[model samples]
Target: MIASTSASATIVEFTTSHGNFTVNLHDETTPITVSNFLKYINDGDYDNTVIHRVVPDFVMQAGGFEFTGNFPLTAIATDSTIQNEPVYSNVRGTIAMAKVSGNENSATSQWFVNVTDNSAGAPALDTTNGGFTVFGEIIAGMDNVDTITELSLCGTTPMPDYTAEQCSDSTFVPGTENFVTIETVTIIDSTVDTASSLNSVKNTLLSTATPVTPTPTPSSSSSGSIAWLGLFFTGLIALRRRFR
Candidate 1:
């Protein structure tokens, strides 16, 4: 059964065959995109789906192929595609809707988890692929996302161009029935109702609790370059002052 997306979708939980991970929806930022995604969640469209396409160090894609036992199948009929809402950047751990190369508003259910700062691929997704809607980020289970990205390949380089909803052939998961599966998607409420909201009577002093922020994964190559540049500038300043 599909779980409810009724609560604050910001703390959406995904119980996968691999492990549990959570995503924080940008509901405030991308309302329409988040709404569309919630519809899929509500209808159980993504249940039992497999990570069909794995682009190492780039993305861990799923929500396309479904399965019964070891056999692969296409997902149930999807709702109409939502308009492009490309407000957020495709940085690491961010989850974005997927679409074909030429079509812009063709996304319906398929999505990807970016394993790296995909700014280099932004042009293909944003400028070329009609800006893949980035509506959420993985607040937890990013390690699971990383694991999915490192799964064994079923085919040789280029992956056989196998994009036809679902394939029953052993082509999808070649050697074993071990491809990563998104077992379940559930939205858990993390909101704390204050005494005031609960009852008009207040007896004790209430302190506003700070919101918990998820630690973001560093952009390896880019962040490292910036660190190196800072060190270089610091050394340059020290050498110039000593010589003077």
Candidate 2:
């Protein structure tokens, strides 16, 4: 499901159930993060994966779990965690890695797209957890990403194109068709090699004190799993702990 272009290659196209979008990787500025992403793509680790987390006006996340025709999504196999590369800002349309709360270098495979300007928004990602590593930006098909964000949530999972009526129907039986699936990811162009203008923004919110794990609410699902409890709550609490 992953292929390279003959030309200078740096852009990757994601074909999803809703549509397609292309991302220009920050190969020079965030080499470690970019290389980590490409390894998962080349290994076919992202194929058939579902965008398991969607918070309206926040972030739409994927690359952590895959659907195998069942409930409780399967966690994708991960390599060792990569070093933190917080060189860029988490602005709108940018893509960043999701990691355990307080651990700057804990990013493995899970990633999220900023639906809003997270750097200046409620979750000032630039100041959180050594700053979420922004490694790429959506170059084209941002409308598709916007459409995906508008999809309604069924519990914590976003149901692609499923209407509110359909989601509210008690008789509705959710299936793989209901989930937003990443069909294929191909390297469209590789010529691009520059970082965004938003690069070099240092993270000043990283704390040297030991990280204190928050008490898990009774409703809290285990960290790294897709069963989120609420919207911003999970985005803040779970993602901070083990959402990756």
Candidate 3:
């Protein structure tokens, strides 16, 4: 019923058979990935789809294999594939786009979530598999993630239709006799109202952009001159203040 994910707090809720979980899409960081995923959401293509593949303690994936009509596997339709935007690491709870080997920009509909932190190796998943794009992150209902990950697999009984070569996680089942079903996925705009706070932030940024460099005062070696300069500036200040 779910696969996995984000930044502006676009909370995407996934109501599944096991339970409901929420993810916030990282719209600013991974724009291409988020836009692509949202296309599927807007089309309602992911609704009723089963969480077909589950690798215990690794990841739980969906959005590609659809179980319908006699409850069989049917290839889900997808729009044009999107470029890989793997900005975030494949850490636990982050959802990354799934793609075939060697094809970096082949990510279409399929996605996965890290049950465990898969961020290891020399370059790690950040530079591996054409960089799996992490577009969102689970914000709530981690219990549902646990429930999906710990589910029993079909083992040798349920192979879904595709050949072993085509699908890698074919043996995965959501649970015994029960597959996780994603009822619907909706986005929640949790954008912070910065209109009021921006005034302070703008002032801070302005101060940072240009520091207040103090004007150097003349030394006492020329006490008379220094006093005259100070008096002149004081008069100027008084005049300026009078204008105000």
Highest lDDT against the true fold, candidate: 2
lDDT of 3 by residue, 60-165 (tens): 7788755554324566787777787766677778788877555667778888777666654322444554556777778788888887666544431122233333
Q: How do the residues 171-225 of candidate 2 rate in per-residue lDDT, one tens digit apiece?
A: 5455788789999889876665544443444444444323333332434222322
The lDDT values for all models are 0.54, 0.69, 0.56
The positional error of residue 96 in candidate 2, measured at the CA in angstroms, is 0.3
Candidates ranked, most accurate by lDDT first: 2, 3, 1
Ten contiguous residues with the weakest lDDT in model 3:
235-244
Q: Give residue 219's error in model 3 in angstroms.
A: 80
Give me the displacement of residue 203 in model 1, in angstroms: 46
- TM-scores of the models, in the order given: 0.65, 0.76, 0.65
Tell me how candidate 3 scores on lDDT.
0.56
**Regions more than 4 Å wrong, model 3:** 1-9, 156-177, 190-244
Backbone collision count in every prediction?
Answer: 0, 6, 10
| Local error of candidate 3 at residue 121 (angstroms) | 3.6
**The CA-based lDDT of model 1 is what?**
0.54
